[model samples]
Each structure stands twice: as C-alpha cells, then as structure tokens.
Target: GGISRAGRDALGEATAKILASANTYENQTIFLTGSKAYTLKEITSFISKILGRDIPLRFVSLEEYINQYLNCLDEYWVRLWARTYLALKREELARVYPTLENLLGRKPKSLEQTIKEIFTDKQTGEKESKLTNKYWQASTFDNK
Candidate 1:
C-alpha cells in the first residue's frame, strides 16, 4: 500500500475546513494527507514532463551536500545528521488519508495537479523561468 502525499496548500485548506467543524472531529486525531502517494522519482518525472525537458537527476551523498553547504558545522554532528537524512529517505513516505477529503467535502488535488500548481509557469509552460534558460543552455552529454 502506498501513502498519499498532500500538497502543502491543499493540506492547509483542508486544515482550515476541518477546524471550522471542530465539533465534529473534537478530541479525535485526524490524519490529513494527499489523495495519492508518489515516490521522489515519480515527482521528478512529473516535473520533467511539465517542463517538456528531461531534468537530469544526480544522486549525491548527503555528506557531500552538507560538506559543500554547511562546512561550518561540527564534523560529528554533520555525519550524524546526514545518516539520519539518508535513513529517512530510504523509508516509505507515501500516506493516503480519507480524513482530508472528508473534511474538504470535495476531492483534493491530484499529485500531478498539485505539482503543476507549484512548479509550472501557467503562461509559458516553463519550469521556474530561470531554470528554463539554464536547462536549455546546458550542453547534452552527447554533445560533449
């Protein structure tokens, strides 16, 4: 079974609605989530499709990112945090919840639609405008 990933804005909207009917869900723990689950790879693929370009994915160790960006931190803590991040990434994050839909009284946005709302440029169909130019300007590996 896959877990659903809710868009942040969608989740917020659902939360507001749920709160408005506090009497109904009072004293109960409600699970709020997107209507569907998606893996990181799936999300990346969707972004690529919307951009109409292949986005290169490069896997780098957490240590590398930390070393490059947070070198001021203590070595031991950095390694510890990186290990924790790696472990979390390896786990399943997809969560499906009916509570959100029930609370909203309407179907929540699908993962694709949610992603498009977040990443797509409505006017030009380009991914973050800056990235579009960079993506197009980069030479393909075949060219090099």
Candidate 2:
C-alpha cells in the first residue's frame, strides 16, 4: 500500500523540473504527491525496519485508541485526526495516481527505499536520530 520505486523517482524528478521551470507554473496550484499510497500499518513496518527493531502494532477502533490513550485537552486534535484517518477506505488509499509519473517520465522509489533514505544519513550511514533507540531503552515493556 505504498509508493513504488518508480513513483519516488518520478516525484523527485518532478520537483526538480518544477523548480527549474518555476516561471511556467508560478501561479498554479500543483497537487504533487506520491503516486501510490500506504496504510499506517505499512508505514509503521517500514519505520520498524529503519530502526532495526520490532515494532509491535495493534489495530483498534478510533474510540478505543482515543479512550485508552488520549487523556488531555491538548490531545483532542490527535483524537480528531485519528477519527478522520479511520474513516477512509483502504481501497481508496491503494489507488495510484499517474500524474507524477507522467510529469517526470519515470516511476517513483519503493516505500522501503524511501523510508531508508529518510532515516539513514547519506554521509555516515547512521540513523538520522537516536530518538528511537532512546525510547526503546527507556520503555517499560522489557520489564513487563
């Protein structure tokens, strides 16, 4: 349920081209996005791989996630967002858009590759941040 490699490449190329020819599309609103879409579960799996750890996942209704986890007034927006996300059909998200591919004359990268690129540093080959490591270490799951 994620973008293909061709889609990623197409998106990058399209961005570069748009920037180069800014004068042509200066006032126009362009809807540029990944040709393919991925579900939250797929995205989390990619993140787990990038972090080199197993990330436990559980599916729950919007009411469950909100009632069990969200407790503060400040977190109301998160509950709203989750409700909105859960409302969409999986089929709707799985549909691919060819606009990006047509514009760039190529396909985009796979979801896995894109996640790796985003999480790994280009020069050092290390993860972009140690936050995941810290969180895992500090979490009480192991103790349980």
- Using all chains and alpha carbons, the TM-scores for the candidates as numbered come to 0.67, 0.59
| lDDT winner | 1
lDDT tens digits by residue: candidate 2, 1-144: 332233445566888888998998899876655656766567778878788787666655556655655676447676665544443433434556676666776655667687788778788888845345454321111111
Off by over 4 Å in 1: 1-3, 71-92, 123-126, 130-144
Q: Where is model 2 more than 4 Å wrong at Cα? A: 1-33, 67-73, 128-132, 136-144
Query: Candidate 2 at residue 25, lDDT?
Result: 84
Q: Candidate 2 versus the native: TM-score?
A: 0.59
Q: Which candidate ranks first by TM-score, i.e. highest?
A: 1
